[model samples]
Target: MGWLAAGEGYEIALVDGKVAARSTSGRSAGKQLKTLPKALRDHPEVERLRRFADWLDRHAASCVAQVDAWMVSALPVPSAVLGEVWADEAWQAALRDLVVVGAVGEGPDATGFLRDVSEDGELRVVNLDGETVRMSAETVTFPHPVLLPDLAELRDFAVELGVAQKVEQIYRPTWDKPSDPNQRSSATSEFAGGRYPSRFALAARAESLGYRVSGGYAVHRIRSGGRMVEARVWIGEPHREDDSVTGGLSWSSGGRHLPLDKVDAVSWSEGMRMAAALYAGRTGER
Candidate 1:
């Protein structure tokens, strides 16, 4: 099949279980995807593509996580490691276009794009500024967006470099830490009373309120209390008929359950709003 374009200015295609986006126009069109119709989105083939896209995002995030750790822990990485992993296309793609700083003394933070490596494992960097610099450190860092002083300017720089991040990095909200020192979070929703004639209607109503349908759940993600949490309201278990009654919603962080009372303030309200929206759609045709 030919390329299926999703968001504006970009066409997404699956090649061997991997999703790749090619820019069709000069501008970024990430917002265009939010309008994808439910029917088209739920199509089997489309779902597969989205899964692949999500995988691509996770891969990029994994690379970033590793780099962030290397920076934070002051871990000493062998130069050979970079030379080795740099040859892997997946690793390279994840690392490409990210702002990388040397282990402090190696050099100032630079926008990484093109590079060359020595046979011995030393890496030479060519930044967005068209300047060539060498990092002599054993480790590198990919700092969080909130920690970057030149974040705004760097985003513009990324655009110039044709760095279209597959992950939600550019816009995903970040906090210095969770606002709640108690490390507690919970979510309560008024959507408990709503009933739906079908799962499609339930999902549609939630979508109207900006919740995303993931698998058998309608998911709402919120960043609060120093955590990125998700409230997943059940639409149905997989393989269930559209008429199935969904179970209660639940809150989680990093895949672990979050208590309803401990749910952060923002998460609590948004979760309730999503629940309320879905609840309103649940009707037995009465």
Candidate 2:
């Protein structure tokens, strides 16, 4: 952004998302000041720039969050919608380089790393064949890492191309349920008995990691195979102040517990991922 005259002799502009000042008639005529001049601290231009910077920060975070939600649910988004938001810097930053799959006809799905969206709503992507392809499909999906059949190969190719995604997809950690019935259960105690200083601390950890705390349990809800399943870990009473210990992780749908064997691949991986993250923050183990 260009600098605007803030006071009699100073100009102000947003630099690195913060208001910065420069003298227009002194020894530092065109050089940015080490710090904002006191006289320009309350200038209208400076205040406006600060507010704009704040809005940009919020907008960027909101974009990332929305993209993350769509990826997690493997939701199919219209190609036109992508074109509509592509012009916005925040939206572009969030959506750029994400692995997208176009639902073309029955031949084979078009999969590639998203590169651009045209004004006419066509998507341009870099395919696995090291070629840029344009897709005009009605809808496209950001499939979950677990659902991508060529996830490992994609990761390798992404590295080769030096691709970096604002929202994690291909590189996100995942787990698979054991095929043996003997290893499957209604709940798993693998991450249980992790000790925290207090119930508040444990709950706070869950919330900080974007999980919900409900009825004394830390819960992660996932949509899998057209149904919603909740994976929860006991975090002790909400009103309790004493030390708390993490408990077993379990999955349920429609208020009925589901065995690990019945849990879908995405749900199982995400559940274990959440449990392990919470347990990693514990002060000790029981």
Candidate 3:
């Protein structure tokens, strides 16, 4: 994802040649706040997100434990609308039934865990229990709006838990179903600015947690079949944005695009390294 961004004209990739590193550098620090001290579990917003999470688990059962569907394109709605939205009797009723069925799970505190913190640092009240849930600035990290789920983590987890086949087949169907009416309305009507058209975003959290990487190349396409995904890329020297612009002007030369293919399921850096390896093969042979 990061490589794609670099290829398409995003100039801010880091100097380390690590795409994941560059992305984490650009995230809003607020996302780290998702972890609230246990003492604050009773906070309203925490309960709300918990409830929301439970609701998600219950209704989106197909996607609950799988990271394959990581890209959940959503609008950043103003904090004011959360209550009204959650207050929809039908939604609440569904939530209540979810709680009854143990699908929502037990809340550590009176407040649920699903929460949203306003930009002003105020807790918004959700209709789940009519309580104000607090937002933790520490746990919230605002990443690039286009990031997708880090499937590598899920793949590892599935292997560890021995659910690889079941999870892979169930959670990520061959095709995505149509958006629900409720889901469509939320995306179209109630989000910040407007709908986010970009469906995939790069995950920096996955990188910080020790996913290997190879990046800073250009990707032409991604091909997936029979449980394998391959990234097609091109190799070229890594140059700072300024170097490319000025050098191009001086020599009256445009950029050159190489033909390279990087393997998938490797860290972002490793992926780029694969591209470099291919490039080396051609040049060294010559």
Best-matching candidate per lDDT: 2
Number of clashes found in candidate 1: 11
> For residues 154-197, what per-residue lDDT tens digits would candidate 2 score against the true structure?
99999999999999899998887778766655337788889999
> Which ten-residue region of model 2 has the weakest summed lDDT?
101-110
| Between candidates 1 and 2, the lDDT winner | 2
Descending-lDDT candidate ranking:
2, 1, 3
Residue 282 CA error for candidate 1 (Å)?
14
Per residue, candidate 1 scores C-alpha lDDT tens digits across 1-286 of 4677555445656655554455566565433343444435445556778777787777766876665444323345666677788865666665555456666554453335335555466667656576777666565555545556666776777676666643334333443324554432322323444557666777677677657888888898765445678978887655555574545667899989986666655455455556656766666522
User: TM per model?
Assistant: 0.41, 0.93, 0.17
Local distance difference test scores for all models: 0.59, 0.89, 0.27
Where is model 1 more than 4 Å wrong at Cα?
Answer: 1-79, 109-119, 128-130, 165-286
**For all the candidates, what are their Cα RMSDs to the real structure?**
12.8, 1.9, 24.1
lDDT of 3 at 50: 53
The alpha-carbon deviation from the true structure for residue 141 of candidate 2, after best TM-score superposition, in angstroms, is 0.2
Judging by TM-score against the true structure, name the best candidate.
2
Count of backbone collisions in candidate 2: 0
- Give me the overall lDDT of model 1: 0.59
